[model samples]
Target: MHRHSDAEPDWDSLRERIIGLGEHSIHKSYYPELQDRLAELERFRALLDQTSDAIFLIDAETGLLIDTNESAWLQLGYNRERLMRIPFCNLIAPASLAWFLEFFASGQNRARREQVTVAGLMTADGCEVPVEITIRFVTFGDERYAVAVARDISERIRTERELRIKESAFESSTNGILIADLEGLLIYANPALLRMFDYEGVHRIQEKSITDLFSCADTDTRLLARLYREGAFAGEGHGRRNGGSVFDVHLSGSIVRNDSGQPLCIVGICMDITERKQMEELKREAYEQLRKNIEQFAILGDHIRNPLQVIVGIAEMIDDPLTAKILNQSERINDIITELDRGWVESESVRRYLKRRERPEASFAKIFRNQNNPE
Candidate 1:
């Protein structure tokens, strides 16, 4: 039983050993509380290494890595052995290191979260990573260090670039573009669409219905309903600009969807067709004009033809020789009269040359006068 009791903890010796280690680490004159605090920090560091943050301690003077957390190995593409050998700045992109060095060299304590555009990485295979860094300054003993935290922001940066490309395409598109949310609240409009409605900016167009710009609002409502239900709509509609001038436009609407296939927004395009509409109206007016002209010619032909036939019959019925001669001449006259009908020939020329009523053809009158006068 006494031999078994010897196996129990020697609490006094254990306490003395811990106290002796603390004295070795600090001066013998150092307060016990200060020594105790240093011990607590070592225990806290062991716990901090297990976290997901890419944590590292950077020496204040040289920015060399003194220690790193487990997350640094995964986030920075490095294993512990490789990371431990590198300066903290060696893992950072050159441009970013310059910016960071400025802050560190200032000697003023600082903390910030920043997007570093370029970053070098350290991998188990001796490769490097580009990352966004967030850091805070901390003091250990008499020395200062920075606790740098990092994350791989490559995906976020790629998304941002894609957004800029889409924006550029929308801005430069030729079609008149208008974008509205699911509630039909206008959120954006391209330059072509603004010029279409004579709106100077998107502000003037916000919250206004697609119907508001239309000369026919009821038609626009039906069109919008079809677009929502059918996912697309295309038809001609009339629109009025700021000056109250109306024009024909073909409106096309399309529904925008998200990755989940949920309806996100409505995009509309307006294509002008004013000249085509004007041409159609002009054609309709031309057909009516042609009809009226044909009717007038039909009536004129009936009036002129009927009177000439009766005059021709009376001239044939005459009996006396002189009267018969006159009738025969009159019959000849009727032929010219028919030929002169409807201003087709000059009327004054017919009067002077053919009628012979105290007037005669100039050539005939001259020859006869010379024969009869004999002077």
Candidate 2:
């Protein structure tokens, strides 16, 4: 099928007919059509004026802005009449203008199609405003014009910068950081987290569930409920590393939610506390040993004191010089026994005091040394 050329229509006959009707139809149809066309132009102007984005219609051949929306004047801090003569490059930054000119001179291939880019737009006050611009080429009558839309994206740029900083902090942190989806499967893990779990790479851990990280029974269920309800959960847990080795871990986690308050993911940090847990167990064992030693000393002291008391009583009954000597010797022996008993009591008291005060290591050492040296 052959497509017809878009040629101008023949309006001479129509005009002649209107004149032959004694100008009556001129007021009826011609004036009304003119009014309708004018009204349509007014509507188009309103659409451009009401839009929030700055719009500029530029001459493609000369690169001069021929028309602009009201927002363009407000956004660029320029008067409506003065901006009509402003070249499009005047709105671009000095440094950016060079590249803009180079690209524009490369013909309208890129401009003919829809394109979006980010650039700095020079404001009237000489300061630059970063804007996201979209441009397209269009033809009106016999002339070509580039229609450009520019939007201020300061807030978007600021948010993206903050996101980059946060991501850097997360990546460089020493503590293990991991993020898991609502289903509890791992989505992301930092280097620290991968090392903590003894995994060579994050790919090995992804698609794994939180249950794989813990040795405690029912940890996933309990933690999930707590995190979703309270939005945070923190405490000690048995974290299983690679090769099935279970180690003590202090896990801190919180729930992440979307704007609508729906659960999105869980973010958590983990620290290995295996050495600290081992130290506590050792201290407990030492404390128990110290208590047993004190009890044994008390028992031995009781048995020895009873025997010494009997000897003292027998010696007191004698009256001769030899017997007096025996009494004196027996009294000396009793005095020595009393000192031993006192020493034992003093050591036991010191052990009890230290232990009660939570100095288990000190109490254990003191008791052990006293038993060996009897002081």
Q: After superposition, how far is residue 354 of candidate 2 from its true place, in Å?
A: 9.2
User: What are the root-mean-square deviations of the candidates from the true structure over C-alphas?
Assistant: 21.3, 11.7
TM-scores for every candidate against the unseen true structure = 0.58, 0.73
Evaluate all candidate structures by whole-model CA lDDT and list the values in order: 0.68, 0.78
Q: How many residue pairs clash in each candidate?
A: 2, 0
Number of the top lDDT candidate: 2
| Weakest 10 consecutive residues of candidate 1 by summed lDDT | 359-368
Predicted candidate 1 versus true structure: per-residue lDDT over 184-267, tens digit per residue: 677888888788889898898888776677665434455555567678766666778867788787767789999999998999
Task: Evaluate candidate 2 by giving its C-alpha RMSD to the native, one decimal.
Answer: 11.7
Tens digits of per-residue lDDT, candidate 2, 1-375, equal 544544544466567656754444555667778889999999999999999889999988999998999999998898998888779988998767776776666655754356678888988888898888887778899998888899999889999999999999999999999999987789999998899899999899999888789665634565666566668766777788888888888777888888998878899998887887798788778767867776776677678768777876776776656777776776787677677667777877877776688632222123223333443
